[model samples]
Target: MNQYIDIVLRSVTIYFFILIALRIFGKKELSQLNTADVILILLISNSVQNAMVGANTSLISGIIAAFALFCINYIFKKVMLKSSFIKKLVQDKPEILIHNGITYYKTLARLGITSDELEEAIREHGLEHYNEVKLAMFEIDGNISIISGNEYLKQTHFKKKIIHKNLAGKK
Candidate 1:
C-alpha cells in the first residue's frame, strides 16, 4: 500500500513538472517554433519519461494533468487578452519579408530565414522568380504569405470583378 502511494506521488510530480516547464518555456506561438523548438520538445519528452510514468500514465493522473494544462492555458489566454504586452509577447507580429520586389535580407537574417527559403515558400504560391512578388510576409502562425506582382493582381482581379458583375446582372 505504501509503495503504491509513493509511486502515485512520483508520477503526479513528474506530470506537473513536464506540464509547467512546457508552459513556462514561452513558445506560445506556432511561428516561434523553429528547429531548436522541435529539438527542445524531443529532449524534454525524453528526459521526463521516468518522472511521468513507468509503462504508461495511469488514467486518473492523466486526467488531472489534462485538466491542469487546460486551466493554465485558459488563464494564460485570459491574461493575454487583458495585457497588450503579453499579447505581443505571445503572438508573433507580422513582418515584411519582401517589399517592392526586393527581399529584406537583414530582416530575413534576423528571423533566421534565408533568401533561398523565402523563394521556396513563395513557390507554393506559384512564383517562379523573386521579382514576381511585390510583397511577402511571415505570418504570426509561421505561414508565408506572398503578394504577387501588380500585373498578376490586375489579371486576377479582372476575372473576379467580371464574375461578380455577371452575378449582379443575373440578380
Candidate 2:
C-alpha cells in the first residue's frame, strides 16, 4: 500500500475509535473539563499520534493525517444531521431534570447530578430554589438549562456543569 494511503486509513480508524470510545464512556461535558480530563485528552492525542502516522514523522505525513481527520469529521457531521438514527446513536438525548418546579430525582441521579449542583445552577439563573424553575433540562451538550417561572426572569439560562466523577454513592 502507498504510504500516504496508509496514513489516511490509520488516521480515519483512530478517529472512529476515539468517537466510539467517547460515546461509550459518556463524556458529555465537552464545554467544561476538569484538570484530569484535560490531561487525559492530551495523553490520548499524544498516544494516538504514533498510531495514526506510524513511523513517518514527516511534515507531509502529519498534514495528510490531519486532512483525513477533517474530512471524516465533516462527512460524519453531515451524515449525523441528515440521519436521525445516526444522530441518536452517536449522541445522548436531552434529559429533563425538573418540570413545573418538580425535581426528577431519578433523572438527576442517573445523570450524575447532585442537588447542590442543581441548586447552584438555579441560583445562577436568579432562582432561589428548584420550585422557582419551570423547566430544568440537562442538555445534550452537557449544559444545565433552566427556565424559571419567575415573571422577571422569563429567559432561559444555560450553564455548563463541571463534570464530576465518582461522587459519593453515585455509581
Error of 2 at 126 (Å): 1.4
Q: What lDDT score goes with residue 119 in model 2?
A: 91
lDDT of 1 by residue, 32-146 (tens): 4768878977887677654544454677655544564566568767998999998875566888988878888888877767677787777767677888888898876666788
Pairs clashing in candidate 1?
A: none
Off by over 4 Å in 1: 1-43, 49-57, 151-171
Question: Model 2 off-target regions past 4 Å?
Answer: 154-171
Per-residue error at 71 for model 1, in Å? 1.5
Give lDDT tens digits, candidate 2, residues 1-171: 999999999999999999999887774546558898999999999999999999999999999999999999999999999999999999999999999989999988877788988897888887898788898988888878888887786645556787567675586
